[model samples]
Structures are given as C-alpha cells and as structure tokens.
Target: MSIKPSRGKPLDVGAIGLGPDALPAMADTAAQSRFDFRAWWPEDRRELPYELEIGSGKGTFLVQQAQQMPDTNYLGIEYAGQFARYAADRLRRHNLNNVRMLAYDAAVFVEWFCPDASFRQVHIYFPDPWPKARHHKRRLIQTPLLRQLHRVLTPNGFVRIVTDHDDYYAWIEDHVAQVTDLFERQPFERPIGAGEGEVVGTNFERKYRREGRPFNALSLRKL
Candidate 1:
C-alpha cells in the first residue's frame, strides 16, 4: 500500500511525546474552567495517578480538565497522526506539563501499557460506533474492550462512553447493563464519572451535533 503525505506538514513526533516505552509527560486551565486549574498538578510527577482520556479529539476538554484538576494525572490516546500532533501542540502552546498523549489503540495500550488498577477514570468520547452490521464487530465498545477497561481501571474506576448513534447507544446500554460485575451504568451526569462525552465543537463532534443527532453518554464503574 502507498501512503501519500500532505503538503507542507512537517511530522514533529515529539510534539505529542509519543515514543518508545511511553516514558513521560501537560496543564491547568486558562480561567475558562472557572477555577484555578494550574495549582493542582505536581511539579515532580514520577508515577501513575488518577485520570485519562481516550480518543482525545483536539484535546480541548482533556486540556481543560488537566488544568482544572492538576492533582490527577491525565493521558490521551489517539490514533490519527495530525490530530495527535494538534493535541500535543495545544498542550505545548499552553505550556501545560501535566498530561501525556499517545497514538495507539486503546485495546493495545490497555492490554500492554497500562498497569493494573492504574487509572481512576477512562474517557471514551465519540468513538467510532461501527454501525454497519459487518462493522459492528469492529466497534471499540465490545466485550473484550469492556473487560480491558475493567482490568486496567481501579476497583471503582469509571469508563465513560459517549456516542451520537441512537441504536448504538441503546445497544451499548443493553450490553453493559447485562454485565453484572464488570459494569453498572450510572446517571448520565455522574459527576466526573462520564457523561455524554460532550459535543463541544471538536471539529468532529460539531459536525454530528449540528445535524441534530441524538447524542448519548454514560459512565460505568468497575465493580
């Protein structure tokens, strides 16, 4: 297969700090969070801590959360090359040193990189629903994915799933609701558990939201 590069796009890998062994790490918010976001993160971060975001779109929300809640560590996993760079650039441009990001599959990272009971929160925002029958099996929200979510999360770790597909939303609701110990759905706005993944104009969510699509979000905790 041949991959053509876009014009004038210099590939700066470090812009997102994605490298071998996934060694290290971004920020507090810029008054937008209505709180002093930069005061919570540690000046000397050395180990795993609290929260993370998967499929971090343009990284706006992740950046804000990292800034507002500095006490908790944040990591973003995104596969798209440009968007990963863009997320990294946003963190750097904002001078945030509390968050780290990687361009790898959540399943792979969950299976390999993350330690047991490492994360307090897992954010899966606007994941590909894979609506078609043939593609349904490829969707990220599956039995195996949920199992991984449960394993990597702390005892009470929470997984927030956000989507705009009504059918997919119901399907997920039904699937997770059936799992006794693996998951339990909480209110849509489960404080910090996970809500509708918020469609706050992330270049992609905006397109879906503007079309008057019915978005669904839920937070499920690991039992």
Candidate 2:
C-alpha cells in the first residue's frame, strides 16, 4: 500500500539557519493540514517540474543541475543540520530560487510527507554503508524505502543511485531484487556536468575517487 501524507509538523528548515525570506510564506504559516509540497512550495516555482535528492551534501549536485535546468525545481533532504544549512546557504548564494533544502531524516520525510507521483527523479549518492553487520539495519536502501520511492515517483520517473561501498552495493541489489515488481533496474548514466570519470560529481564521490575507490551505479525505472 502507498504511504499517505500526514498532518504532523514538517521538519523546519528555517530554524536550521536559512532566513525567513528564503522560504515560502506558506511554510511560515503552517496552516496546511498535510505536509504536501504543493502547500509548501514557493509561489514562483509552482508550475515547474521538480526532483528530489535523498542526500544532498553541500548542495553540489542541486546547484549544478538546477543551474543546467533552470526550469526545473529541486528539493534536497540532508540528515545533518549543519550540512543542510550550508547547502541551503550555497543555493542562496547561487541565487537559485528553484531549489530548496531541508534538514531531516530523508527516509521518514519521503515515506510520510511526500505526495505520491510528485517527483520526476530521485537521486541517492554514496549513502552510508553501515559497515558493521549490526548496524546494517540502519542503511537507507531497503524494502519499505524502495516502495516509498516507487510510490512517490511519476509514471515516467526513475531513480539514480551511486555508491562506493561494495558490501552496501550488494545489500542495495538484494533490496532492489525484492521490489522487482515495482522497479526495473537499468544502466545508470552520469548526470550532466559530472567530471569525465565521476558518476554524479558530489563531494563524497570526488573524495572517494581521489582515494581510488571503485563505485557502483544503476537506475530503476518505475514499473
């Protein structure tokens, strides 16, 4: 079953460091009964198509991609408060009004607050591997999360994933296997502006590449 949006208080990006003016007025009012993007989106960006980045570190991918596609809107969810603040600030510095940043647990936000069939794409890059077996349960790529990804994607939307951890890549593959009915795995293509050899050109990918790490990437089209 698809998860439904809730009336719970959404994670406040303003309190983390962004100025009031940077956010939409509706977000400040908190008058909406449900945490739907339409209710929180900036007025000027209402008509633009949007995408979500599950772990937008430092806003690199959003900044680059949003600049490339000025007509598209982008929302980035980062778990760390400080990183979210920095990323939001970075987007503001770039004067990219089509992008927004939120500091919250990406998994929870996606599963509970996101509207169904709302996104054109979802990007996940270099998620924590949780190397220890006991902590593997905490990893982001799992059955429930996969279902949410499927639920929130548009009919023609797809998911793009890139990771450097071999063990975690296997885990992601296993979870993807469990959701074959919902997604069809496909080859991953590097996003525009990525470096010659880089997959997504995020900070983590650049850092890992410098260390000579092997990466795995793939795409999942909503089925």
Candidate 3:
C-alpha cells in the first residue's frame, strides 16, 4: 500500500514516501495542462449531474453520496496524499465507478481545471481554520477563491460549508457577505432521522459532536 512518489509534481506526496499509484489513474497532473472533465467520466459525460467536494478527507462523504445518488457523479479533491490515496483505494475496492479523486490543492484545481457553470453542488467540509492571525491568509474561504467559486458554479448551484471553528465561521460570513452580488446566503437544516434527528453528518462532524464541540453549517447559492 506504499505509494511511490512522482517527481516534479506540485504536491510532493513522494517526499512523504507516497507514490503516483496512490492517485486515480486519470488524475490531472499539476503540469499546467488543460483538464478534460468530459473525458474523466466519458460514459456519463455531460449527461449526469456533477458534484464536487473540496478537502474530501478519507472519502467518506463522497462514497456515501455516490452510493446514495447513483445518477450523479462525484469528484473529490484532497490536498493530503495519504487521504487521497486511501479514498481512491476505498472507492476502487467498492467498485464505485461514479466517483473520482484528485490529490491537489483545492483552490488551484478549481481555478484552473473546473469549467464555468459546471457543477450542481460544491461541498467544503471542515477546512483548516488557520486560527493564528498571522496565518489567516492561508484560510481557504477568502474573497478571491469565492469569486472563482462563483464563476464555476451553475446558476442556482450551491456551496455548502461546515466548520467546527467559531472564528473561522465569522471570517467566512464576513467574506461571503462581501460577495453578495455573486452569492446569497441560504438556510440549511441537517437531515433528520425518525428518532435521532440530524442524522446526516460527515466523519469530522460526528467526531466534533462527540467531543462536545459545536459546528456551523452555511450554504450559498450562485446568483
């Protein structure tokens, strides 16, 4: 299960002793090449609705969604090589052909590879809060990235974000407010089960809940 690293890639997974095989065979390389989403899933190309998840750690959400909605295609981008490899392997093992993964920086991938107005939904769950004031620049939900997101989403497409960090939640709200012309806030309710209520949750969401940490969820629609 050791992944051999490939040289000259933006993500130095190899530096961490992982290999190219850790990624999906069709994964887009970081060498400034144009991405072809239609070719990525040729069998269903442009026919099925597409959804993407950023920072899709360990593939739990993607796998579950792909399983539950067979008519839609799922793509996940994970910056961490270990998580990306594990997720790819998990999908392969389950023989889930409706999903694919990329081990790449989420912002860069979205800006360069994704086509405009292409996705039905985008999920960003539990991204790094980058809590330190000095490290705030590293936070993912910045205004620049928000613009890119706005461009890539189809009209009425939604971006769903969840975070356990309070400061980051406020930060996201502030920036999202600045982009009111491109996006508008939408209300979200956690899926409720017959007995438990609020049944739908990601792996991190469950862990944070168990630890007594409150998390926030936000949804925005492309305008």
Candidate that would win on TM-score: 2
lDDT per model, in order?
A: 0.66, 0.78, 0.74
lDDT winner, 1 or 3: 3
**Considering lDDT, where higher is better, how would the candidates rank from best to worst?**
2, 3, 1
For candidate 1, write residues 1-223 as lDDT tens digits: 1222335455343444463344321113212212211123445663546676778867766766776666667878877756776677677656667777776676766655555676788877777778789888877777767887788788888888778888788778777866767887776553342235554334445667668677777889788
Worst 10 residues of 2 by lDDT: 1-10
Alpha carbon RMSD to native, model 2:
8.7
| TM per candidate | 0.76, 0.84, 0.81
- How do the residues 81-100 of candidate 3 rate in per-residue lDDT, one tens digit apiece? 77787777767656677777
lDDT of 2 by residue, 100-208 (tens): 7877777867765676888989999988889999999999998999998898899968999999999999999999999999999888888885867778899888888
* Ranked by TM-score, top first: 2, 3, 1
Q: List the residue pairs that clash in candidate 1.
A: 26-96, 26-97, 26-98, 26-99, 27-67, 28-67, 29-67, 40-70, 41-70, 196-217
- After superposition, the stretches of candidate 2 with alpha carbons farther than 4 Å from their true spots are 1-34
